[model samples]
Target chain A: MAVYTEISDEDLDGLLAQYDIGQALSCKGIAEGVENSNYLLHTETNFYILTLYEKRVSKEDLPFFLGLMQHLASSGFMSPKPIRAKNGEFLQEVANRPAAIIEFLDGRSVKRASPQHCGLVGSALAQLHTAGSDFKLSRKNTLSIESWRPLFDGCKSGNPVELTSQLLSEIEGELQYLEANWPSDLPSGVIHADLFPDNIFFLNDAVSGVIDYYFACNDFFAFDLAICLNAWCFETDGSFNITKARKLLNGYRSIRPFSKEELSFLPLLCRGASIRFFLTRLYDWLNQVDGALVKPKDPFEYLKKSQFHRLVETVSAYGLD
Target chain B: MAVYTEISDEDLDGLLAQYDIGQALSCKGIAEGVENSNYLLHTETNFYILTLYEKRVSKEDLPFFLGLMQHLASSGFMSPKPIRAKNGEFLQEVANRPAAIIEFLDGRSVKRASPQHCGLVGSALAQLHTAGSDFKLSRKNTLSIESWRPLFDGCKSGNPVELTSQLLSEIEGELQYLEANWPSDLPSGVIHADLFPDNIFFLNDAVSGVIDYYFACNDFFAFDLAICLNAWCFETDGSFNITKARKLLNGYRSIRPFSKEELSFLPLLCRGASIRFFLTRLYDWLNQVDGALVKPKDPFEYLKKSQFHRLVETVSAYGLD
Candidate 1:
């Protein structure tokens, strides 16, 4: 939950002047998206999300995010379209930060994902991958397999007292194993790298919208599924619900059939995905910004997920047979 | 900025079942209102504010707050009416907290108040006072003059490190003076005790809405003006703007003319208002909730305002004849 920048009325007026939408009726800071300030901007015509990109999101990569949204939305995907300004740019500046007005899709993100919700999420994510296949812009996943070791090192150096020595050594061993076994060349495309349940909105038992494209990047589509497995299939008690995993995978495969190589590499990719989140969460936990509106998510949840995936021998364990 | 309660989908569904406002389309937690969890709820029919009262707001006072909004809005004041449920009740339960859905008013709170904006705010506030005059419910101001000494004691007990000995003594002296000289009689009615700039919204150069009735209660109307004087007339650098104050007073009197006694007591009321905020702010600053999203406002801002009000000899200092 965050609104890092306060957009003054002058800034808002200047921004609205660049758009043909309408005059600003109300602009409220919304408690969503930690990487940027988000406002639920109501205008004379319609409601739109006004986002001011903070320091965490690179201004250079904004076009890729905004462009990706435009591309997917135009291609009939569930992504909300980024509204181009009168200057024909999706990106603009507000309160000294990169900003944009985005179409407001009407759907509430589910607090708890049922098997049905997971199925819809899986299909929506696959649709996103298919819709984004021909997008001209591309960005490499910054928190992918290669960045794990350095992130782990940074977390270790930060000296988080909560991380036990045994836990640290276990993470190091897992990182080493993942570094050696992580798969490459497995049906790469645009992946919603962080497709947690919170990022997928559900209405009337269907995925109504997908949002928060800050982490969207070019990566293995199977790795995106792996991320979903870790995010959606896990219960609060740290047990994997294979039924949900089956529903998610089956839902995805029904849309875009997975290759044999992709299925074989699924377990390893899941482990890598867990390691990626575990390391980043650990880093954020160890080096939490003072007065940050968002509480750093617990790193151990991903650690347990990594441990679970480490024991899986084949796609059969994920009920993907 | 706060969203303390996380309402689950089931809770939201249960809430909507009690209302006829159409099925829930979306509900996004908004970074507005420090004392409650506020969501910008979009239903199939229209946009509304869904607020879940936090512990800071007394449960018994829920009816008064909601009812006062109903009274004001129905009487054609700028206040947003609380949406009643199918049973004709203005309040309901969500996530084990008292909650209500309020009609969404369209306007943006000013970031910086111009003198013209001040004039609008003044007239709107007077209109609120006039409209709320006949409301059956009455709540005594809990944070008024009598509560200042106890709040000051709490702050002193907390031993805020930033407060110097001299500052403490000055506050104590001011408290003594206010207690001795606080007026017993002036025109009294339901007052929106917390009329900060953010609590008022404007559109097309007029006040479109006045909100956050949690602090509304029976009090001297001139004291409400005094609160606005401290809130809207002070510049960021702590200088009082007499031009803005004059406009505000004149604008308010144009709506409901002030009595001579009310005018004579304005300076002392301003000091008391300052003390009221100073003690509460100091108490909050010294005892901030751990991991609170909203930062405690600097207590010293009110101290400076209190000091400024202390030296004012008459209403002329406020740019009045």
Candidate 2:
């Protein structure tokens, strides 16, 4: 749980004076995560999560996040809507941090996300991409494949420079190969870039809501699918779960059938997803300075995870050929 | 990195002063965690972690945890020692919660833990258990097989409940059978119950430090070995990794050879390990009453994980017999 701001009863009450949903609220710190701060809020009628902007979250992107929620909500997306303030604004200040609130979704994420649920999630994801196709704001996917080099550069360890350099070189080569061959002009829109197992909420065996929109941005929908592949489809030991993979893709294609181009790019997108997490882990590891209360996670775990993904790419390459 | 207490910069500096680590320290909140309020404290001397006790951690058990660290450090174990204050007391109060400062470990975990490193870790772990033979404390393995009944009771629910229940019933039968047959008293000592890949640290390709002592407790050392079978030796798809498993076991046996009784009890320990994590995930799923900052992990993932462990137990049972 990443909760960054505390919304006092008075503050929440003051803000709720305008919402149609009715009544003031009180909130407590939920958790502060690497990407966002969340507070759990209780109101007269319902529970909600109040998120404060973190460093990784840009304020300029606030509209995209809040607007996306409201848009989806208006479209009967079955997702939480961002509550507006008395001033008809989605953003507010809490704990000296910029914040917004969303209705708490009922239900929990599946432990083993079933093939049926995977299909449902895939269908819902396609719906999101299609619905968001014409969103007014255009923010590039911050965690995309092209972003890999900068992320790799963050691992500026003077020693073992060869390892870091080699990783970057490998990543750069993949970028060039993808850029030259990956399909462009495929239907594109805002995609949930980090649809890990922990993020999606399910109710009655159906995906009720997709939360955590901090990583949602303009990108090829397939890349989002790739992220989910790395996150949800893979097993603990990093195996490519072909059965689950097929269910996911089948479910997704039912709503938005893949173009030949998009299908061609899927393998590369999967490789990109693996590399992204790997680089982020490496960056966090290299930056572990002293006096931190929480231990920095091992970058090598993701590095090893990437190796598994690479094996998948090698195998899939042959399949495609 | 869950640190559960409200803490400040001054609090961190004061604790570091006791350690005489001559480091200027800053504390940052870790945003996403279920169990504790974690902070990354950076000091002038070196990076270290400060954890504020959250509700799940019992206050009375602090001594066992702190003492275990001290015991290991005193016995020349290459792990962090909880820094003591000017009063030479390891425990301190932070944000009205029990707090301790621990040395931050550097370097990444070996991506694919090599057989040699696995062997080294196995020997180090055996040595750790041997060293803790006389420590004056006792606590139940909070998530052991014995705890599964209560957890299953907690998780009983709607349509899917029957399937989960059937699994639990089978597990329960296994538990009863194990209890009737397995030896309990065989070279008992303190052991790291969750010695997974993420817990240990490597520096320059050597075991820099063993960490995440939150799950450490007094248990039959052989049980710890059984746990490693499921954790370190298993392949990606819950498959038995015979070669890696043999390497790990042989390495540990070389340091502290198991008694025949201990060898016979290994299968039960493996089953116990499966139930332990399964119950934990189940408990976590049931207990998520909303307002959590972190995403409640899928309890179902462990369903598959535990299934594999059960398989390993069956395999080990035959081999030992």
Candidate 3:
């Protein structure tokens, strides 16, 4: 779903010569990452990932993301550590794009989520939040609730009335509600705002690593938990599985206990997370180009999810014990 | 450019259990190969290529392609060897597509071909023809001269007069000339008809491997050489580089000497090869679908190439000694 730029062999050789890694055996563009072009680089001795930040990623925000990964790795969190060159620089230019090499993590993303996988993911997320607390660099989440209205307006011109009429009114009502009743007392820290199932890898029923930190930013720690509730606790048939939610919440609580205030606003935070995703998906759906590699995910899925979150009135409804 | 089917984690574990290879550490869909979805699979022990043949490839031709790779590898050729499962089957189903795991080859495909690279490729190709001579199975080249006319007709509907009018007449003239002057007697054997630069891998000015035997078939061995002349001896501007051609021919002659008759028909064979690729590219150009991952290569490049080949009247024009 990625690989927008083709890296030349000469460019690759020059890039690798700056590092301790030996000659590259092969460098294949990996079909994962959506925001950056990723190559699974194999050298004579080891494997690494070569990432070229595409136009979608902000160049100014790279240091924060890279430094955050390095800090987390140094803190014994399982994440890909950025490999430095002989000059001690981690970021360089490859094919005129900002590129870097990171140590390849050893695991695969699980497709079908089991309760055990959910538990491991939750524990890892909490650990990430805890480990990143002291990192010097911080970034604001660009895709937060404040950005959703503008994104929706960008897509308003192209969509049909049938698709937008109900969606628009409901979104308006929800945005007003969120603005008036937003929580202000919860602990704020670095949060992996987009830690879906695909971003977490597992080996032997344990979390091996966390990945795709492009959305990592200074946000509510409990908001990250709320994002996971919407992402992990939902089934394909539009029903919420309370068992998965229970396990995930328990796993997270074991690391850093949630405060009573954090638990009380979980339902509202989940609703906000649903709207954030629904608006983005709707924008992408409305503005999809002719030859995109990845298909736009259906916005209706998140709309139905928002409707479900709106029905939940108490924190215990999410299966938190 | 491939990966039409998604393989789940449970299915992957089940597939690997059938082989002696250990647990898969990662299986990334590689943005290489157009006809098949290829994953650069890494296990706890070694690396392998997991290929899921896409619909563009004929299922009935799997054995010939896989068998050719196996036969050449056993004969000390550097192509990837098909890894057999414990049940002794090399071809199996994964994600409902015919899939096989092959040993990973080291070395990267070069973007710019040096004369030395061309020389090594020519030498390796001659060795491949020699190694495949005794293989039991045989496949006819489906994209041979007989199919060019039909392929042209498929594209004739959409192409503009500026691109097709003169091209049509010239192609018709070349086809007639080639048909009348085609050699009736020559050394016939298995040949890799599509040995483009991308299909040949190089390491330290030496050929490490040859791959993509999907187009291997029973054909004139010299035709393979002629295909390489058209493929490897051309610059980006459509001019044939005589120095590179000289090295390539010398390298091939060093291994398997060509007959005088074969050399005499080389110019005609090169023209035929050019038109064969040109028609196919034109067909793909006219029939390209929206949202395809890979862009269609320019058909005009091959058209220009065919025009260049049409003007060459003797073998020496291709830098034959």
Top-TM-score candidate index: 1
Tell me which of candidates 2 and 3 scores higher on lDDT: 3
lDDT of 2 by residue, B203-314 (tens): 5446767776778877788878877776777556655556677767777778788887777567667767766676677666666644344545565555565565555544
* Better by TM-score, candidate 3 or 1: 1
- Point out where model 3 deviates above 4 Å: A158-163, B157-165
What would the TM-score be for candidate 1 when compared with the true structure? 0.98
For the predicted complex of model 3, DockQ is 0.78
What are the runs in model 2 whose C-alpha is more than 4 Å off?
A: A1-321, B1-6, B10-23, B30-34, B157-165, B297-321
lDDT of 3: 0.87
User: What TM-score does each prediction get for chain A alone?
Assistant: 0.98, 0.85, 0.97
Residue A64 CA error for candidate 1 (Å)? 1.1
lDDT of 1 by residue, B123-145 (tens): 98899999999999999999999
Give a tens-digit lDDT track for model 3, residues B92-203: 8878888999998888887888888888888998999899989999999898877877776776666543354777787778778877877877898999999997798887
TM-score versus the correct structure, for each prediction: 0.98, 0.49, 0.96
State the lDDT at A109 in candidate 1.
89
Tens-digit lDDT string for candidate 3 (A1-321): 788888889999999999988989888888988889999998987989999999888999898888889999999999899999899988989899999999899888877899888888788989998999999998987887789778877767756544558767888898889878888778989999999988888887788889888889998998999899889989999999999998899999899898888999999999989989898988888877667777898888998889998999987788865
Model 3 earns a TM-score of 0.96
The CA lDDT at A269 in model 3 is 93
> Comparing 2 and 3 by TM-score, which wins?
3
Candidate 1 chain A weakest lDDT stretch, 10 residues: A155-164
